[model samples]
Target: MIVQFKDVKDLTSSPAKSEKIHVYKSGENKGKTRKLNAKPARTGILPVSEKTVWTWVREGKFPKPFKMNGRTVWRLSDVETWIAEQESKATILKEGA
Candidate 1:
């Protein structure tokens, strides 16, 4: 049985566990399988929240995401560059100390 947000009596109210709610996870999500890099030059996985993504992009610290049809995505190269940069900086600080 599928329920909608509107069906809830109150937004602040909690529902009984027996209500038969169904959450889902796609089969691919259950494993350590990596995402298909369909567009290697224009797609990636970034460890960031939406808020921080936008901020970093605006500040030029992050790569500007590329558009696929209409959806924006980051390039794996850009993400790797950022990660390597961070690691380099960390090493420098450690060596300085």
Candidate 2:
């Protein structure tokens, strides 16, 4: 499922640390439910390196990170949505070809 950024931002704007975010899993665990984290776990899921992630963020291909207690964190939902979008585009291209 693709999580909207506005929804994520609204949820994070509050002081509720216990609030859990829903993220869609891919691969063997596809369609499974998972708890979201603000930690940088993009590389584990995405095929790109840490530097590429930062580059994508700078180029507007990726979502901008949120600041949490002096630590830069990305909403897991946003990352998942971005990944889904990329995969969808790839599928479209392959189909067209």
Which candidate number would show the highest lDDT if scored against the true structure? 2
TM-score of 1: 0.49
User: What are the per-residue Cα lDDT tens digits for candidate 1 across 1-97?
Assistant: 5422211111113222322323345664553444332321222244344566678879998767766666565555566677789889999999999
Candidate 2 lDDT by residue in tens digits, 1-97? 7543332232232222454667566677778777765543221555555676678879999889877776677777778788889999999999999
TM-scores of the models, in the given order?
0.49, 0.55
In the order shown, the candidates' Cα RMSDs to the true structure are: 18.8, 15.4
The positional error of residue 25 in candidate 2, measured at the CA in angstroms, is 48
Clashing residue pairs in candidate 2 (N, C-alpha, C atoms within 3 angstroms): none
User: Candidate 2: what lDDT?
Assistant: 0.64
Clash totals for all models, in order?
0, 0
Model 1 weakest lDDT span, ten residues long: 3-12
